[model samples]
Target: MMRLSRKAWNNVVIISMLLMIFFFNGLHKKLNTQPVEEGVQALLPEQSFILAMAFPELKIERIGTSWRSQSQQETTWQGNEQQLEQLVELWQHQKLTIANLPVSKISQTSADYVASVWLAGEQLPAVYQLYNIDQQYYLLDKRLQRVFELEQADAAKLFPLYPF
Candidate 1:
């Protein structure tokens, strides 16, 4: 029978302990880590949103599950409840990705429209600008360079025509 030397035995024990530690650490991280969803971190209240547009300088607010808009003519327009909810949901779940270009590189001078969203009881709104680059629609944050790509149809929903 052959026996390992004391030094060899100690080395073996140490290496085994290290392997166990690494294995358990990886398992712990895998089990504890949660998947993050891509979207705005802000928690939107139920059936509430305030949408403000730049081109037309229009402001719309959700009042008691219904949407009301103030047009350029200084008239109030009532919005469809279901349509409003759908629009709000689209914005709420819209997944955002990091923009390849920085804010300085992107030119906002040719931007056709800008929109901002504010939740109920919130003083500040999340601002976004809509731009068409090479016929592709891009939605970008005013303060941040993060951008979201969407089809033209989806982008059009952000600027719904109000019934006055």
Candidate 2:
């Protein structure tokens, strides 16, 4: 058997501990992050940055790092900067699932509110139809032919301009 001095043993233990820390750190990061699942996509594609979002009653646009929000019903700015920025952040990170509800689940009575987003590099703005049915919220992307279901809180965050 190889014999080691006390000093050598201490150094070896520290080296092994460091290797373990590094290994576990890498492993933790890999485990903590969720794997991308099929049929799940970001609300806004990361490649394109959003320049503005115009809902039925309000419009918010990026003015450098800050944002400008104004009422569509009127020309006055209604919401504060912090709220507008949070709305932008939510749109940037929120993920949407491809809705699989049956046709019968959603009736025809739900009134649709339109939300338009102007993205960077796209000449035409992307438009989404928002709906609230039985307190559940949905955003439909007509171009993609997909409906994304959202929770009530998230729906409120997306369309705070409205009374909903």
Candidate topping TM-score: 2
- Listed per model in order, the count of residue pairs whose N, CA or C atoms clash below 3 Å is 0, 0
RMSD of 1: 9.4
- Cα lDDT of candidate 2 equals 0.77
**12: Cα error in model 1, Å:** 49
Task: Tell me each candidate's TM-score.
Answer: 0.55, 0.65
30-122: candidate 1 lDDT, tens digit per residue? 999755445533323345545532325566566665666565555343356576667667766555444455566556456667777875566
Worst 10 residues of 2 by lDDT: 102-111
Q: Write the per-residue lDDT of candidate 2 for residues 1-164, one digit (tens) a residue.
A: 87999999999999999999999999999999866555778887776788998977788899998999777686333678987888888888888876775434544545467788898988888877777776777887755556788877877777676566
Model 1: residue 9 alpha-carbon error in angstroms: 53
Give residue 63's error in model 2 in angstroms. Answer: 2.0
